[model samples]
Structures are given as C-alpha cells and as structure tokens.
Target: MGFSTEFNSICKFKSARELEDLFEYGKTKMRKSGFRIYPTGMKVIAFDPENRAVAIVQIKASIAEIDFQDREITLVEMDLVRPLTPEESAVETALAYEMFFRDHESN
Candidate 1:
C-alpha cells in the first residue's frame, strides 16, 4: 500500500465500541499480570507473508523497551518495511488495543 493508503487503513476503526472491546481484553490481562497499561503506539509491519511484525505497543508503562524476540541489533536495525495483510493487521491492532485497555482496567 502507498503512504496514503496505509494511513487510511490504520484509520479504519469505524466505532468506539470496537476499541472498547479491545480495551476490555487488555484490562483483563493487566489485572492478571499486576501491571499498568499505556497507549504506546503500534504499527504492523508486513515484511513478508510469514514475517509480519507488530511494532512497539505497550512500552514503558509495563516495560522499558520492546525487545522484539531478542533480535535487537543495538547499533543498527532495519528501517520501515511493507504493509501487513488484512488478517495480520487486524491481529496486531487488536492486541495493542486490548493491551492498552487491560492496563487501564487493572489500574
């Protein structure tokens, strides 16, 4: 997708209730984990069909930084990648929204 298309795709949340649903799930996890939640921002990077990655979502609110499965290069990491598929993007967005809301409910 182009830049504009990507922007529009991210803006596809049609209703507050959708976000609310995600928030509720996050709240549940937060209560169980004894952690606080914050909206840390998320991006779904689709480098490939099987390499789609979810960028940082829950950051310093619960942890300092995103460790990305221990693939941190420290000195040099890759830049922005491709766009995620519909399914992959949906999952990442839901996870981020759920995590944020869960943290809120826990606190």
Candidate 2:
C-alpha cells in the first residue's frame, strides 16, 4: 500500500510584473512603503516519501532580458493544482511566517 504524499515547490520571481501575475489569484497586499508579497517563481522538483531527490532544481531558464511585456518562457514542470484554500495558503515561508496575521486588517 502507498500513501498519498504532499507535494511542494519553491519558486522565486525576479521582477515585479512576474510576481504580480503569479499572485493574481492570491490575496495581495500593497503597502504605502511600496513593498509587496508575491509568489516565488522557482523550478519544480518531485520527491517521494523517502525524500531522496537531490536538493537541486533539475531544470532552469536563462532569460537574456526580462522585459515584462515581451517575454515568453515555458514553466518546465506544472501539475494541475487547485487554488489554495484560505487556510492552506496562509502557511508562510520560514523567513516571513511570523507576520502571517500581523497586518491582516489592511489585506
């Protein structure tokens, strides 16, 4: 018998527009200080229950120029994922996880 595993991906977005597009469906916050919180656009990796995969991003893209309006890059790996439920999506990365509800009134 096998267990259904929890899949995870860590993405890093390089520009503002790219970040904006990634978080379109997510709750966005714009501060008066001009900072934002968006999804990280990183390559995906798959790991089974044993967690034996190399800690390396298998595929990568090198953009000569990152012009938001005139760029096309295919994301190498993407499995259909349902939009994150509010509770599920609320989980944050270790770096910023502490502020999850600190500024919720505005968002």
TM-score of each: 0.24, 0.25
**Alpha-carbon error at 48 in model 2, in Å?**
26
Instruction: Kindly list the per-residue Cα lDDT of model 1 for residues 1-107, writing each as its tens digit.
Output: 11111221122222344334333443111111112223334332322212223322221122222245533111111222334467876686566456443453332
lDDT of 2 at 33: 17
For residue 52, model 2's alpha carbon misses the true position, in angstroms, by: 27
Q: Residue-wise lDDT of candidate 2 within 9-45, one digit each (tens)?
A: 5333233543343345332212111122222344443
Residue 75 accuracy (lDDT) in model 1? 16
TM-score of 1: 0.24
- Score residue 31 of candidate 2 by CA lDDT: 15
Q: How does candidate 2 fare on TM-score?
A: 0.25
Model 1 deviation from the true structure expressed as Cα RMSD, one decimal place: 16.4
Task: Estimate every model's Cα lDDT from 0 to 1.
Answer: 0.30, 0.29
- After TM-score superposition, the amount by which residue 42's alpha carbon in candidate 2 deviates from its true location, in angstroms, is 9.7
